[model samples]
Target: MWRQVALEAFPDAGIREPIGASALAEAELRLGRSLPTELKQLLLESNGVIGRTHVDTVWTVDQIVEQNLFFWSDESLARLYMSFDAFLFFGDNGGGDQFAFVQKPERADVFVWEHESDSRRWVANDLRDYLGRSLSAGGDDWYQ
Candidate 1:
């Protein structure tokens, strides 16, 4: 699903093989959050990092913060970084509902539209569906 999303969203994007456990540990240290085990396993077992070869993209939460892109550090926000053209972090809503900070609010406005409430309600499930929709929407035109 992640590969499909990368292909559909960027088409020309390059995929990086999973980083090793040592690197992941370092990243966790920088991020200050223990990555969910499932998420860590997913990254370890797949070409998890996706980005355009010509563009400067960072995957680690620390990199996101160092670049002042912490608003894009959450899993859902990461999906936006993967699939959209631009984004910015919006202020946090307590009770754990944090929105992305988007450069163009209109683009960010469609997050819930593309993925239903339940679709965006969970990280792993939401990530899967997001990638699936991106690929499905692009259709066969994307695969070649």
Candidate 2:
């Protein structure tokens, strides 16, 4: 799903795997926001890249840290970035809702997508579309 999204969003860019748990916990500690359970589960389940890519890529928490892609502290800032990167591409379907937050001290950026919604609206069913669009907008160069 993510791969498809990446292809659509960034046909020229490459998609990678999901980051690891320990890294996620560290990011959470740094950001001071507990990730939503549903989002966590999806990342865990996905294990590797959730989007499309021409080259095989693996997204580990360590890689994110090494690349220095920390979360933003300001909610509004985080919301803006996520809105542009993740949500806008995915659209507000009835599948789930995804959001981004930053770790407190470290300020690492973290993405969370809620699987269930009160209104029964799916936010990220089309993983390919969401990831493709998100990645297309310079996300591939995020780690650089």
Candidate 3:
């Protein structure tokens, strides 16, 4: 149904194959935390959602693991921005900003991390809202 949700927003939204439970388990192990329930459900329905201009509205599990690990551990990023240990990044604006769930507090709400200023702010109420907002829009910076 998640794929349908995306398609409803943008008929051209690209859908990928659903990820298996084992891959999700490994992803959680690598992140050292469980995936958000809504996000997990979405991924199981469709591994990722490609939005306008081919942006990853929802990333695949592998991308999720790699991006989060990089944001949490990269020394260069650590120096440039606030620590990312509290965020589980899931998508990008195709510019430099990224979208994420609050991991430290484990909230369903989604936030945007504006890359240049290192600012994080509320964007969508939840994963479904995020898909609708991002996919239905016409640009990468649609959240803005």
C-alpha TM-score for every candidate = 0.39, 0.31, 0.97
In order, what is each prediction's RMSD in angstroms?
A: 11.6, 11.5, 0.8
Model 1, span 1-144: residue lDDT tens: 455455666666555666688876876676454554534554564434333333222133333334333443456756654442243222111223322323343321313212223232221133444334333343321111
* Structure candidate 3, residue pairs in collision: none
Q: After best superposition, candidate 3 residue 68: deviation in angstroms?
A: 0.3
Q: Against the correct fold, how does model 1 do in TM-score?
A: 0.39
lDDT of 3 by residue, 53-137 (tens): 9888888999999999999999999888889999999999889899999988889999999998999999999988998899888
Local distance difference test, each candidate: 0.39, 0.38, 0.91
Q: How accurate is candidate 1 locally (lDDT)?
A: 0.39
What tens-digit string does per-residue lDDT give for candidate 2 at 83-127? 222221111112233333322332223443443321122222333
Error of 1 at 84 (Å): 19
* Residue 36 error, candidate 2, Å: 5.0
- Model 2 spans with C-alpha error above 4 angstroms: 36-144
